[model samples]
Target: MKRRAHLAGLLALPMFWLIGIYIFSLVMLLVTAFWTTDPFTSKVKPGFTLRNFEQLVANPAYLSTAVRTLVIALAVTVLCMLISVPLGIFMAKIAKPWLRALLAVAITLPLWAGYLVKILAMRVTFTDAGFFNWALAPFGITGPSFSITTVVLTLTYLWLPYMAVPVYTAIRQLPANLFDASADLGAGAWRTIRTIVLPLIKPAIIAGSIFTFSLSLGDYIAAKFVGGSTQMIGSIIASNINLNPPIAAAFAVVPIAFVVIYLLSVQRTGALERM
Candidate 1:
């Protein structure tokens, strides 16, 4: 009884915050999404309506922005996985202790920098008169201007550490004998990884992707800094939040629904449980 009481006590605060704050906020957002905006006064009108959602679906611009946001989010996730796996294996399986520490530090160092600063730095690098263009000038290669590609690259740089660190940690926690056993069985490096290492690290990869995908989905600042005129779902929400809050709320539901569906789908794979 005492142990149960203590456990309940420990959980009470978090449970309150989750239910009272987070869930309540979501409820409010849902209610707000059904509201209507008065065009004459440009004020939010309290009511239930499907016009906001109908408009959201009917607007080509909004649809394009949603698709673009999803594409960028997916691109960032894939790019991070591509970069993390080989680097994580090297750090966990091969690098010396000091070298591993150095690599870990290198991977995490960018995270300490301000997010705005990083976006601005990318903006500078991708600009025509900036470092990237200057370096490529001798090779007669032009630098990429602010565009969807720039947005993806900047976001990938920002979120790579989130994916890499978890993947590296997962690899480190793996039993060393697994690799040795695979080697004894005549399994090559790639084959061992495909059969054993990859399977074990799948949970960690999913965990990292949750961070990258959700962050990229909601990112407006990076798009603002380096996306030129390209707008994302986040930017659309930002634009409408004050003048037409109902529409913003309606659009906000898109990413929220995407993330919830994604989580539910991956949960079936046992990724969330492992995390």
Candidate 2:
């Protein structure tokens, strides 16, 4: 009882800080999404109003930007899963400790570098003299530059580790008996992956996909330097921040609301899984 009381006291301030800082800020945002701002007075009205939200819903530009973001986010999610699943399963299957460690470093080295620098490196490396165009010459797949492909590839590289690490963790956690059981049941390597491996990592895939998708969706610098005039939601929101703070707030609220609902669905699915 005494130790319990001591731990409770230790946790009290952290809990308070989490609520006051993060939760309260989210609540304030939800409030501000409705709180009207007067252009002349520069004062935000306290009462609820949907003018900001309606403006976002009515405008095709904002709607298109959001749709584009979702499309890009989903593409990134698929690519991350495609890469991470095999990489993670391979890491988990590797028996030697030093070899696994080397593989892990190779996987995460890209993430260790700064995001801006990574994108810039990609940008410079994609020019006519850059590796991308040079490598593509034989294939005849040439383009001006910074196409949707560039944005997708840049975002994918940026968030690759985020997906990889989680998936590796999840795969490593799987029981060894599951694989042995599958083999004993006459399942081939492909069948084992299709049935046993993929199902086991569904939670990790979903979690990592969400994280990577959110990161790509919210990335501004990559979209700016490499994806110029692509008009991603991140750039749009950044543009609106100073000029239309409330509208920006509204834009912020939508993604927040989306993630909250998504997280809730994940939680519910997890609970069902537990049951």
Which candidate number has the best TM-score? 1
Against the hidden reference, what TM-scores do the models get? Answer: 0.95, 0.87
Q: Candidate 2: lDDT over CA atoms?
A: 0.82
**For model 2, where is the 10-residue window of minimal lDDT?**
266-275
Candidate 2 lDDT, 1-275, residue by residue in tens: 99999999999999889998889987887777777777876566677778989999899998888888878888988999999988888888864788889989998899778877898998897666888777888999774587677788888988888899988998999999999999999999899999998887887788787788788778878778777578787787889766666777888865666567767887877833532
Say which candidate scores most in lDDT: 1
lDDT of 1 at 114: 95
Residue lDDT tens for model 1, 1-275: 99999999999999999999999998898899999999987799899899999999899999999999999999999999999999999999999999999999999999999989999999999998999889989999987799888999999999999999999999999999999999999999999999999999999999999999999999999999999998999999999998999999999999998899889999999878778
True-structure RMSD for candidate 2 = 2.8
What lDDT score goes with residue 81 in model 2?
93
Report clashes for each candidate as comma-separated counts: 0, 0
lDDT of 2 at 102: 92
